[model samples]
Each structure stands twice: as C-alpha cells, then as structure tokens.
Target: MRILLTNDDGFYARGLQTLWQVLAEDETFDVSTVAPENQKSATGHSITLNEPIFVTEQQKKGHKGFAVRGNPADCVKLALQGELIPRPDLVISGINNGPNLGTDVFYSGTVSAAMEGVLLGIPSIAVSLAGYNGDDYEDAARFVHHFLKQNNFIEGGLLNINIPPLPANEWKGVKFTKLGKAVYNNVFEHRLDPRGRSYFWQAGSLAPETDPETDLYALQQEYVSITPMHSDLTDYRKLKI
Candidate 1:
C-alpha cells in the first residue's frame, strides 16, 4: 500500500526518523515522507496559502523524502497535490515527541496532519509516544505496523493513538478511550526585558480528571490510548429543538 508519512516534529526528529526506518524496512509497503523543515508542534491545522512554500530533498540511506518549509498540515497539503509523491492510500502522522491526548488534540500539529488527510478522503492515523523524555520508538512503531496489518481503514476519518512510554512487555495493553479533560491553570508571568520592555511568560499545569474512560486516564494506567477523531465539530445535542 502507498503510505504518506509526515510529522510535526520536523524531518530530522528522532521520532519521525524511527518511524521511517521501521516502515521502510517493510518490502510490501511503499512509503513517502513529507515533513516540516523545523518543529511545528501545536500549530493546529494552519495552512500556508499566502506565502510560497518550499520543499527540500532529503535522504536517509536508501529512502528519500521531502522537507517542507511549513507546518505539518502544509506538508500533507502539498504532497497531495502530486508535487512530491503519489496520492497515498494511507497517511500516518507522528510518533510525536509528546502525547496528544484530551484537549491537546485541538492544538496538535500531529493530529492536524492526520485530519488533513481525512479531509482529502484518505484513512489516517496520528501516533504519539506519551512522554517527552522517551528514548525507545520500537514499541510505538511496531504497534502502528500491527494496527495497520490487522485492521482495514475506511475513508473519511482518522485515529489518534497515544502509546505509553514503556517497553512492550510493561504496557497494560490498549484502550479505545474518549478524549480526556485536561485543563491547564495558565499564568502569564509579566516580566521586564533587558531593555526594560514588558513581556510575559506563559506557564501552566494540568488539572486532574477522574474519568477512567478518557485517554489521559488510560495513559496514567499505563495503557495505550486510541481515540477516533473526525472533522465534524458539531454539538448535536444543542441542535435538538
């Protein structure tokens, strides 16, 4: 199958590199990669229509990919136009450097890349390792390969998978969980620059949620979290007359 690979963590990110290495080793899969030239984490679904976007050729031994001077969504968008690669049967974004759980999806460039693929009528997935300090990508990459091998992906939606940053043997298995509630208590600490100019630094901490069915809670329990996502943002309950 033709698979388009991209990530918000840029072309050189270890997470993306690990995924590319794993997928490219499979002889049955045809993989093409297009990713940001620099990290574009939390960029959401922003597209670059106003400015000219550029793609640079990059190679990892035998595999060749393109690095786009834009966000994760832009990589998918430009790649789909048939400039860099053929239209893919599947699009897989990330193995993100950090987790994309709960409301974090709203601001995630990883999820947004997959969302853009779904918008173009392709089956997609956003995979993330749940910790920033993770050193192993084996479990996560293998999990993605197994998921695609075992399941049939229908068009029109994407899956968000967040793996606990643990070895395969230590994991508590997988859970299809809902988006969790993780609201941050944000604080803008005002400060003066060297020039005596006013500035602010934003900081926050996650507020806990008790729901066990949520992705956040699943992660806390050491389980891999899988949450299905779609483009529709409608609040259907409110539409009831």
Candidate 2:
C-alpha cells in the first residue's frame, strides 16, 4: 500500500515520528511524508493561495520526506499537485500531540490534512492521542496499523480516530461515535510587550456537554473513538424545508 503521512504538529513532532517508525516497519507500505515545517495547530482548513509555498527535502535513515513551509492542508495539496510520490492509496494524518474531539475538529489542522486527501477522492484517516502530556505512541500506532491491516479503506469520506492516553489493556474497546458538543471556555488574556504594544493569548478549557455514546464521552472512558467525517457542510435534514 502506498501511504502519505502528515500532521499539524510539524515534521519534527514526536507523534508523527513514532507513526513513521511504526509504519516503516511494514514491508507492504511504501510511505512518504509531507508535513508542515512548523507547528500549525488550530489552523483549520485555511489554504495559502496568495503566497508562494516552499518545500524542503529531508532524509532519515533511508526514508525520504518533505517539509512544507505552509499549513497542514497545504502539505497535502502540494503532495498531490506536485506528484510527490506514487498516487497515494491512503492518506493518514497524525497520531497528533493532542485530542481533536467534537467541535475541536473545526480548528484541527491534522483533520484538515486528511480532509484534503478525501476531497481528492482518496481514503483517509486522522488519528490523535487524546492527551497533551502523553509521550507513548506504541499502542496508538499499533492500533492504526492493525486497523488498516484488518479493514479495507472505505473511500468517499474519512475516519477520525482518537485514542485514549492509556495502555491497550486499559481501553474499554473501540466505539464508532458521533461528534459531541465540546466548546471551550473562551478567554483572552491581554498583555503588553516591552514596546508597550497590546497582545492577547487565547486560552480555555473543554466545556463539552457529553453523552455516553459520543466521541467526547468515549474518550473520557478510555475507549478508542472513530467518528466518520466529511467535507460537505450541508445540513441535509433541512433540505426538505
């Protein structure tokens, strides 16, 4: 299988590195990476159309990749437009440094990379480890590899996989979940720089209204949550009105 790997956490992120190491071990996978040169978390689906984007070639062991001087979505766009590798059979984003649950997906560059692949008619998945402080990706990467090994990629859309920050044994099981209502407590701390210019830092905590079956709740209970995502934003249910 030919695979394109990417992440919002940039080319040097530990999560992406771990995923690359794990996937490279599989002889069946012809893997390539095209990811951001710097962290672009919470960039959403923005594209760099007005400015020229750049790519730098990188090598590790015998594997080769590119670092994009743009957003996560730009990496995927460049990969396809430039034919960076053989037409990818699958596009896998992340094993992200943090969770992308519920409404968090709206601001996720990781998910946006996978969505770009899906828009181009490729099977894609966005994987995230649901803790900011966790460093172990052994189980998370294993699960992702196993999932692709056991199941055929379903095209036309993408899967959003969020793994709990725990050992495999601690997991309750995998759950196909729905997006939940997770909104942060919006706060902006205003400050002044040495030049006396005003600045603000956006910060908040998750304040989601959870249901047991939703992705937010599933992650809380140590279950792997897989939510199907699509590029279409239309609310089909309202079409009849």
RMSD of each: 1.2, 1.3
**Candidate achieving the largest TM-score:** 1
lDDT value for model 1: 0.91
Write candidate 2's Cα lDDT for 1-241 as tens digits: 9999999999988898888999999999989999999999999989998999999998777658999999999999889877877789899999899899998898899999999999988989999999888569999999999998998885458999999998898999999999888877889999999999999998888875569879999998889999998888999889978
TM-score of each: 0.96, 0.96
Candidate 2: residue pairs that collide: none
Poorest stretch of ten by lDDT in candidate 1: 148-157
True lDDT of residue 143, candidate 1: 89
